[model samples]
Target: MIQNSGIGRVLYETLLYLLDNGDEWILIGNPEFLKQLPGKRNTIVASHAPAFHPREFVGFPRRIINSADVFFTPNYNIPGGIRVPIVASILDLVYFDLPEIVRSPVGRWIRRYFARRAVRLSREIITISEFTRERIEYYLKPGVPIHVCYLGITRELRNQRADFLRGPRPYDFPYILYIGNVKRHKNLHVLLEAYLTARKNDFNCKLVIVGKMEGLRTRDAGIMREFAQLEKQGDIITSGYVPDNELYQLMAHTEVLIQPSLYEGFGLPPLEALYLGRPVVLSDIPIFREVYSDLPVTFFDPLSVRQLSAILENHSWETPTSIDTTLKSRELDYAAAAEKIYSVLKKYAG
Candidate 1:
């Protein structure tokens, strides 16, 4: 979903969430994407779809329309010509918001074109957050109703495990964890500078960056290069890429989970961290506040290293002032979301 990049964990997690609920669903997409679909009963994968431009879908393949009584694409658009009413999920419009870093101009323009068309073609649009829905309404201005269905965290992520088996941690002791991409908007330089300041002030903690360096454009590449140099200095542990099980282990063990992005659509990683009951430090941004209003966290300005450093210096793995998770662990219901999604799809199904 959304370029097959695991970096967009939300897409994959949404699919997994649906499958785990054991819906009678058949996924239709290019063959390569089949590898990423999670296994669960009553799910079928028809990997006959060949990758093609969305415009090419003016003569959209009929076999796809024949395969399902109704269509629901988690992170993609339905072809314009398909007669069946379809529902598609838009995680965010990062490409529209940050075109230079997110995609090449040609690619960005093409995706925007397809996104616009998808809004026109689909019966309904399911967006991850209210923020994304607002962005879609502002830019695409679709006639279709936009639904705000928050994503669900898997029980695997919420595993109850020990912080450490018992040790001094690694590379000079206890560490804070940062997961996800190092894209320009990620505001990583601030996190690095803050970690450095914390170290200077005798906060005996290493910074662990558990993500791969991405962004292929020239300026984005420079950001990656700088991160590589930071890795060389060994002030932080950049664990290139880790599996989910390992990532879960890391989250369970770290001193705090910090998401320093300047902007985010939903910030799924922090929510997952909070699901695991890990303390989180976030860049004080609207989306983060919107999502984590009740969850306990330390807030810092993404641009201010001093503020980030101060938050880190005082954060604890042990305890926090406020930890109300009713919004996440209980109230924000995924089963309700699934039922709502099914109700919409059923209205279109023959």
Candidate 2:
């Protein structure tokens, strides 16, 4: 399936910039998804095999691999038997950092093995956040040069008009926004419980979660119980997948944006909200602090239902002053990011 958010979003923006600027890339994976990007000079080789599948070991067309000077994978799924110099991106040690997320022991082992393989095979490693860099150094101890290229806000968000008014209400009632997958580390179950508690305390806003909710019941039974209860009562709304413009409208009109993830390499929703001059409530995790401490944002303990509930009910924080100006001058452009990565590839390119 085509991934349009998170790591995929980051890759898409970076590749788009590279293609527009000047680069001949041999793209792999789903042709339908990749063919949308500009640059006919770049080659698009269709491969149906998904990442980490056994077929991926030999799935990449030999001619395509042979033509490449250097191979850079956005994620740690390094293809097997490639002779070219490889540069792999370890976005975050999600599997290694949160082992329990993968229920099967063998599955956990496979993840670890591939992660290490990516480290061992790659000529260099690229990660998005300083927090993730520390995690890589401490856990993996990769001796190769590891570069930190902080992810940039996508062009879509950056180019959005400064005075972009909130359009029509995504929902009639006031709602708080949360954008991301329902992954285990996302701590969405905790968010639901806190939202439920806030509701009891007279918080009169709906909880709007924007993401795909398919198979969440099987993946997280505990969260599903809370989700079902709130959803049945119409207190929780799930927007399966919203386009960029619709997402911007939702973000702009939100009462407040909340990110209650227990762990993250770097949280993008809160960053986008801050850039949009929207009030944001973030989990008081190390990565959030390292990346967003300079910005004016409310931080809360992810494990504390009462604390989050009180904040949600009271609505104490105000929209940040001078945030758009601050982010515009900072690490918000993906073109710079693509240039940084391109320089690295040029160094190692044969």
Candidate 3:
């Protein structure tokens, strides 16, 4: 949990689960941050480099660790750069999925290098979804076992009331919501194009894009410029980083949540929409089909603006599609996921 990103949130959930289920757990990371999390009695802030990279391969400061058996990192690499037996969770191989986003030859090579190193050193690999596991197998061919675990819905969702109209709204009229950051691989331009095309058919819905607006790494300037133009026209509204309570309520009331991402370890928006009983229009990707097989979600070709437009035109406030309430995600499977992790750690823990 080096920073406040999706991966950090996932790591926080892993920490919470371990605290409740496992005994004698240890957390190793940045002191000022990881120490802020509960269970301080078990935390150890070993001084590592400014960032978590293979610079650790240069040298791992191990004088701090007293004794440890299995190194369990909720993320790809363990803190202090332990190149030994461990259970490491790799979120995505998106660099391989969308190579154009990699930007640098050396950066891609280093990522591949670190991924192979992480896989080779680990006793087992944990992926967020079966899609990610297959992706890793396709690229790395690491002989270690791969485990798939799904994330649970946020606790804030449970506190959701039917008072959405009472809360502050990002837009006055009906809107389709898109959560998460704007990144190159997200294929946001496709959404904008589709939204514009659908508006011609009187779709009558503003597209609300929500996430942290400032201090973001812009991977594609072209898409950012397009977004700015759309925002100016009021075709799209950007509600930079709404709080969880408001976000979930917004999801509950939105016309439909759209995820046009080209690649994802596990798309949480649709899953969160699953809890909110909101229909999702997702990119026709294998991972969504694999994860939300039971959930009835509209699929669209991510590259084809026509297909997305058609899906949007069909979904409108006047003729709203019935969201299947039974279409819930396997979020409750966290206990089983934790158990599987615990079993693996217990086997290797000496």
Candidate 4:
């Protein structure tokens, strides 16, 4: 069972694809996350595992290889001494790539250790984008097969109605949307600063930040406190951990979805926005360019508030023709991914 976080959702989605196609798999993770899975006969929920904690070795599947043909651990970290054919997803080597962003020494060591183990054990590695694949290859031993499986916007998002009629403002405000945790790498501080600067120039759009407040270190929390003060003064509305229905409605009606993260293996929110036919303003990072270059998304330097403000002030919304096409491509990719995973399991099935 995977823990319920961003990568956890992806892991579960992938597992569902496998099961729907007639494969058996066990989910081992936190109990809260395990409860989210469908109570199907083929699915087995294992004991809870805390985030970043070492995987407990005592349990069913004592010999990892006997437990499953191909063990899949999404978002790095696999149990040590697991002789199974491990297939791990390495999101990004951000801790190593941008060490300045990593705060605690313990966190840094754990990430590095697990990332190295993932490289060593993974027979087939999956990543969200080619840029991240390149990073993994660069940091790890070369020639490890890295598969790029781009995350897709759920079908529910496309069918979502723009219920701007009943919301507090009811089309009274033109708002820019940002949905994600306000962690250090997310660079919410710079985003807030940019929004403030843009508003000074009479940019009449409100900013809506939607995400849970988790992993916000003291420094980031202090910055958020300042933003909260500004929020009281009516600069931004921080809708913390909004329900999906409200989130999709906001995505459907917003002028633009802004993602100014310093790094992302594959940013899902932008793709979610694209699926909703919403225009996107993303950070001018290599990964964003690699994934969204073919699409029409405005890019800005994540480090520079001036650059972000300039882009926000001048951005315009245009419904994308490529959204449906991208969604179709994703469905095909996921099917192929399921097949590939199944093949690996069959090859090593006991």
Candidate 5:
């Protein structure tokens, strides 16, 4: 099990669930992140490979195949030359389908190369949503069994306790939340512009962006400066790399969770907010629509600040919607997701 990503957090929860239910597993990744895993029985093979970069996994195939029964790459990019049943989770084909949105040329090539290999070498494939399933079918060899096992929010986050004494509550007004790394595909500039417009029109609320600054290659730094200017004017709160507890607290108290990602395989934040009983304003993308079709979420165009502003200005907070608890109980639970993954593993292993 190679783990390193936002999705890796979901994988760790799933592995723990599997262990709790009497299935054993090993972890392969940076020792720092894997140290947070629950059980002590599992072995941790320290790997220096950076999660997103494929070059880091250059000679990893033999090492990976030698250790595990079935090799699973949770995010994407399977190590080459492996002699085992490689079970890969292809999160999204966004790199192949939307190359323009990708930050770097190397990132795009790495994704393109490994995605094809994942289809060829894997005995079974997994994806986060049905929308991605179709994309995989179109791009990869036909008839590969691609399972849609949705990612879940951790239970600890659901029952999180907010800190009353935490430093003046971060922002002045209760704000809509946007959580994730600030990447080009995240559409942060558009979100900032929309929030500014909404605030000007007596929306009277702030927008809180919680994530690390990324995408330096695509000149996202200029956009970050613009957001900083907005912050100076008191319309936004830019919390860079917050602790997990604080993130949960922020989600718990947020007026709404808005994710304007241009593309996604399966967005965990909106589902997480839904699980926390917070109102969600998401992009009108197909993946989000498929995952949250039945749920009552406000949708906006990720590319259009005006459309996003309209949704923000016109939202009603009084609707009694339990999307958060419902998703937590029905979809985002680790035990349930682990059961599905374990079942698939058993079927293939047999």
Candidate 6:
């Protein structure tokens, strides 16, 4: 698993829950990595293949798979030669929904083909949000049941400390936080423009972007120009990648957390911030509304830089003393999600 990714957190949380429940299992992954897991009873099959690799499609050990009553994966990609009933998770349809962001035509084709194939082959599908479930129904129109099991906060985020573990604050000055990468659909450029406009209006807080910025390339030239200028001018700071402890501090201390995504399966960062009693500004998209309408959050049109800038300048963002709503009563935690997922797997295993 890519340790810092949103989906990676989901996989880890679900696995932890499953292990705690003490079900005998056949796990597939790097042996070294699988050994680190808590469960001693699990049969780990060593497969060096990464997700979507050609080796994964054909190189999965048949004997190990055949022994299992059900074959389940957190992703849509299915391993070949599995005789058991399959239950797969289709997290999002972003690749099919937004083609312009997909640089490789062949990569897009591969994703579409495999996703469609997984829908056809799976006994049932699990998705994170109702918005994504509807998208699946509209685009793929699957024959099997599609279950909407909302994701939960990671263990790290849930058990966060009040003081910084690293012994110092990330930044001495106030900053607005953005957690995801600079993907085109993330609408980071609009955020940059809004930040610039906010600066002009005397909202002088810096912009701190928390993600890996090693190959920070965006197709939009205007975005690149604005980003370069702000970064050079010391108005924007990019923390390449920080561990969960440090990330909790960053999220905790920020003036506000903003997620200006044009599309998403479930926007986890802002939700994490909300859980911490921090104020959030999210894009006025269907998924954000579906997931966060009951929470204490502000929304703005994703495309309107002026409106966002104005909000940044004018809005009074107070960290709520208490968050009464339980994130729409969805049991937005891994235990519930894992229980629901386990029930589905067991149902199909019969």
Best TM-score goes to which candidate? 6
lDDT of 5: 0.72
Better by TM-score, candidate 5 or 4: 5
What does candidate 5's lDDT look like per residue over 124-225, in tens digits? 888878899999998886456888878776756644533322324545467888898766677777777777678778887777878876542334566567
Collision pairs in model 1: none
Higher-ranked by lDDT: 1 or 4: 4
Instruction: Report the C-alpha lDDT of model 1 over 212-245, residue by residue, as the tens digit.
Output: 6654223345545655675687656878788777
Error of 5 at 224 (Å): 7.9
TM-score of each model, paired residue for residue = 0.81, 0.92, 0.84, 0.85, 0.86, 0.93
TM-score of 2: 0.92
**11-120 per-residue lDDT for model 2 (tens digits):** 89888877775667888878888999888688888888877788887776866786789888888878777888888888888888899888899999888899899999
RMSD of each: 4.2, 2.5, 3.9, 3.5, 3.5, 2.3
Cα misplacement distance, residue 145 of candidate 1 (Å): 1.1
Which is the winner by TM-score between candidate 4 and candidate 6?
A: 6
Lowest lDDT 10-mer window, candidate 3? 316-325
Report the C-alpha displacement of residue 46, candidate 2, in angstroms: 0.8
Against the true structure, candidate 4 has what lDDT? 0.71
Query: Which should have the higher TM-score, number 2 or number 4?
Result: 2
- What are the runs in model 6 whose C-alpha is more than 4 Å off? 2-4, 161-168, 214-226, 316-321
Error of 3 at 200 (Å): 2.5
In TM-score terms, candidate 3 sits at 0.84
Can you write out model 3's per-residue Cα lDDT over 8-125, one digit (the tens) per residue?
Answer: 7677656656656436656656777666555534756554553445555445454443356777766654545464467788989987778777678888776777688788778998
- After superposition, which runs of candidate 4 have C-alpha atoms over 4 Å from their true positions? 1-3, 30-43, 55-65, 158-172, 213-226, 316-319, 329-333
lDDT of 1: 0.68
Best-first order by TM-score = 6, 2, 5, 4, 3, 1
Q: How many residue pairs clash in each candidate?
A: 0, 0, 1, 2, 2, 0
